[model samples]
Target chain A: LDATAVADAEARQAGLVKPAGALGVLESLSIQLAGIARTCPPAVPGAPAVAVFAGDHGVLAQGVTPWPKDITAVMVEVFRNGGAAINVLSRACGASVTVVDIAVDGDVAEGVGTGAEVLSRKVRRGTADLAKGAAMTRDEALAGLAVGIEIANRLVDGGADLLLTGDMGIGNTTPSAALIAAFTGTDADLVTGRGTGIDDETLNRKTEIVAAAVARTAGVDDAINLLAEVGGLEHAGIAGLVLGGAARGVPVLLDGVIAGSAALVAQRLAPASIDYCIAGHRSVESGHIVALQQLGLRPLVDLDLRLGEGTGAALSVPLVQAAARVLNEMATLESVMAGPDA
Target chain B: LDATAVADAEARQAGLVKPAGALGVLESLSIQLAGIARTCPPAVPGAPAVAVFAGDHGVLAQGVTPWPKDITAVMVEVFRNGGAAINVLSRACGASVTVVDIAVDGDVAEGVGTGAEVLSRKVRRGTADLAKGAAMTRDEALAGLAVGIEIANRLVDGGADLLLTGDMGIGNTTPSAALIAAFTGTDADLVTGRGTGIDDETLNRKTEIVAAAVARTAGVDDAINLLAEVGGLEHAGIAGLVLGGAARGVPVLLDGVIAGSAALVAQRLAPASIDYCIAGHRSVESGHIVALQQLGLRPLVDLDLRLGEGTGAALSVPLVQAAARVLNEMATLESVMAGPDA
Candidate 1:
């Protein structure tokens, strides 16, 4: 981020027709965008792309979630068919969707279907049960990250100015909670939540599994190793998307708990990457709140969204565009006061 | 709202591929829209139009806000010129802007400027200083409301499915605060806020003025009488917008404190009108919070917006549209569960 551009944006916001701080978070968001774009008035972001990373969670073997693991592959197909929640929301907000098969347990075809782009970049079929051992090898985690970065690059190079993270993995919240607890040093019970609506007994069991997974990875301080130990393949891919989007000076709107956990890894890998990330919405998932707190990001929207196929993030695209548009298109106080001649 | 449609929407939500309550507020919002539209899956709102009601407050004489009364007229011009915050935001959200001069201290021409439609329907030049006496007669307040209804009808008939409220009046927040306090029975000190960023001293004085005005209107139990006693013309007009929009079964997205105060008037006049109103964003104004509480409305966006030119409401158009789209477009759980044939 360019500090001078941020200062310049601040000065410009002060001169806008509205009262100082009248636009609230939008004022600061515009300034942050200005810094990211290295321009006083950042371009109104168009061509937003949501990258939905599909993978399967090994933690499902522990009875963490009631949903079938095959649902991940099914959802990838649904997303490609433009019939999923993320697809509907992205289309409503005028953003394109790309489904990346980072590590789905089942096969997903690589091609464009309907209005979506499907990428075949599977790092592995699935991970081992993280409750008993590491979720994935360090090499596999790196490969997941590579896939994310590659997808991000492909989207941005293909004319995407804004990137959003989406994920599809049954029982993914278990690993998400474990990763959040591992990095933020929060208790598993506090960070764990029911994924896809689990019962009380299942939630309790999920918490125990999360606590054990965090304890197993307690010694790992490095982000990649921590991700490999307790995180799912989709989490690694999302982290890479964040890092890649930040590297390209494009903002990444993070979805729910899955994306939040990925962001923790992204932040750990490169602290400045956090600056380029926006908490799209606060999810109902407990770990998402902790992850947002650790990232020092305030969500633009809070609709209690827990279905993380980038629906929440996609819903916020207009707001992000509005923030930048206000900076670029609104008349300044001086201009308005100076009359039509000015 | 149609109860059967609402029930049907609820059933449809349950059958959606996502878990129950996963979409959170959006799910409820969709059901509300369904009820409002009297359809299980409401049509996605295609065209949203923001009616920016500009007026002047004689309460400006009391020094409640630092901005000159003339700035109201200037802002109306700015709105018409497509250079104000509201204009930029509305354009970003693909909503049209119509500037309605319900009351202004100065003359405003009635004509289209740039991309905006300007309507000159001034009931009066301005309200009387509320701290000194009643703001207007009951007739003027009714006329203000008539103008709002007429504009709402024109817009909706012209193809706007969503109506949004916008206000531009110097020193208007003082009357808004008084009106909120009068209707909600909240103390002035609790409801009054620094309009357009007032200093500590000015805010204190403003609070005192609001208290006095609320006291003056203590005996006015009727909505129109209460509005005439302490509300601005823009508030009355906005109340009408809410009423007219609701009568037409179109959703009205309300701006900040001023719109909230106006919605209180609308709700008083027609309790069912509140059903059609969506709190766009919670304002930083203390009065808006109380107004929202009294109205039993939760804001879709809470970016601390206080500009009150429909910027907040305009920004939420995409969310509202997405809410409806999700219900209409997303594949049902049965369809996904039944495999490709379904």
Candidate 2:
């Protein structure tokens, strides 16, 4: 952010129609946008795009979630057919949805069928069982990261002013919590949550798996090494997406815990990647708060949302755009004071 | 709120793409709209219109606000010329602005000029000094209420699916604080805030004025009596607008402290009227939180906003609309289960 641009924007904001900072965080958000664009009024954000990275987690073999791992392929098909929550929400925000098969170890080809396009970038099969051993090799994690970076480039090149992070893996939340616990130094028991509303017994088993994963990945300070040891493939993909968007100087709205974990990775890789990220909503997942706090991000909305489809991020598209538009559209107090109102 | 319709809306929500209540407050809001419209999917909210009620407060004599009373009339001219925050925000949300002279004391005709059309429904020149005596007579309060009701009726009949409550009274926060303290049984010192950033002395004086008004209006169990004795005419008008919107089964977005106070008055007048109200944003005013809590309304946005020009309500129009559209346009999970994914 430019100091002179920020000062200028603040001076202009003081001259707007109402009391200074009366719009709450929205006022500061607009000023932030102005500084980002280095203009008094930043360009109105173009239609947003949500990239739902679909991958299967090998942790499903650990009974981490009640849903079958096959559901990942099923949900990917659902997303492509425009019948999922992400699809509905993205369309509502006038945003496009792009599904990428980063690493789904299933009949994903059949899921796409003929004439249905899909990003078949598989970094090998689904990640290895983190509870038993490493989730992926370092090269595999790097492959997923490259796939995500490519997708971000395509979305931004397609004229999207903003990118939103989404995921579609049935048992992904378990790894998300493990990633958070590993990075934020939170206790596994405290950060773990029941993904997809599991029974108490299943939740306990999931917790133990998360604890094992965290323990296995301990002492890993490198971002790629940490991800390769325990993080899911989609986590790496979303991390790449955030890094890529920041690299382009575009904003990326993060969904709940999964995106938060990815953001932790991105921030570790490039400290400034956190600048492009906006936390959309805090979810029911306990790890979300810790991950967001570790990254120093404030979510826009707070509610009981645990679905991992970038749906929460999609909901905040208009709000983010509104913040941008307020910079351009609102009349400065100087303008109004110089007019008949003064 | 119809129990059957709410239940039906919930059932429909369960069938949506996400888990039950996964969409957060939006799911509950859509269900509320369903009950209000008496349909599975409520009518799509039409383009919104903000009725910025401009009034004057005789309480300015106490030096509560540094701004002159004439600024109300000046902002009305600014609103007429589309050069104020209200005008800018309303347009940003694709909503129109309707400047209503409920009881502004200045040269309002000069403010509106000869050719411009404005709603001139003044109940009086301004409000009486609540510090000295009753702010309004029973007849004056009723007249103010009627003016608000008429504007509500006209706006809704003119095809506004939602009515946004706004006010442009310089010293209005004083009355708003008084109303909240009185109705919520809160301490005046607790609920009063520095309107437009007052100095220590002015804030103390404002607090004293609020305490005085509350003490004078004590034992007034009747809602109308309470309002007539200490409320500004714009407060009564805003209360009437809420009542009218409820009568017509339309949602009214309450701006901040003024709207919160107004909603308190309206809810007292009709206990069920709260069902037709939506809190726009939590403001910097302590009284706003008190009033919102008294009415059992959760604001959609929270920020450091003390500006009361319906700007908060205007900002939330798209969010409210998105909630409504999600219910209508989203494909049910049941529908998707029958598709290729299943």
Reference-based lDDT, each prediction: 0.91, 0.83
What are the interface RMSDs of all the models?
Answer: 0.8, 2.1
TM-score, prediction 1: 0.98
Instruction: Supply the TM-score for candidate 2.
Output: 0.95
Q: Which ten residues in a row have the lowest lDDT in candidate 1 chain A?
A: A333-342
Predicted structure with the largest DockQ when compared to the true one: 1
Per-residue lDDT of model 1, residues B1-342, tens digit only: 999999999999999988899999999999999999999899999899999999998888888877888888888888888888888888887899998988888989999988589998999999999999999999999999999999889999999999999988999899999999999999999999987888999999999999998988766799999999999999989999998999899999998999999999999999999989888999998889999999999999999888899888988888899999989998998988888875
Per residue, candidate 1 scores C-alpha lDDT tens digits across A114-195 of: 9589999999987779999999999999999998999889999999999999998888998999999999999999999987
TM-score of each: 0.98, 0.95
Deviation of model 1 at B27, angstroms = 1.2
Instruction: Tell me the spans in candidate 1 whose CA falls farther than 4 Å from its real position.
Output: none
Q: What overall lDDT, based on C-alpha atoms, would model 1 receive against the true structure?
A: 0.91
Assess the local accuracy of residue A21 in candidate 2 as a C-alpha lDDT between 0 and 100.
71
CAPRI quality band, candidate 2? medium
The lDDT leader among the candidates is 1
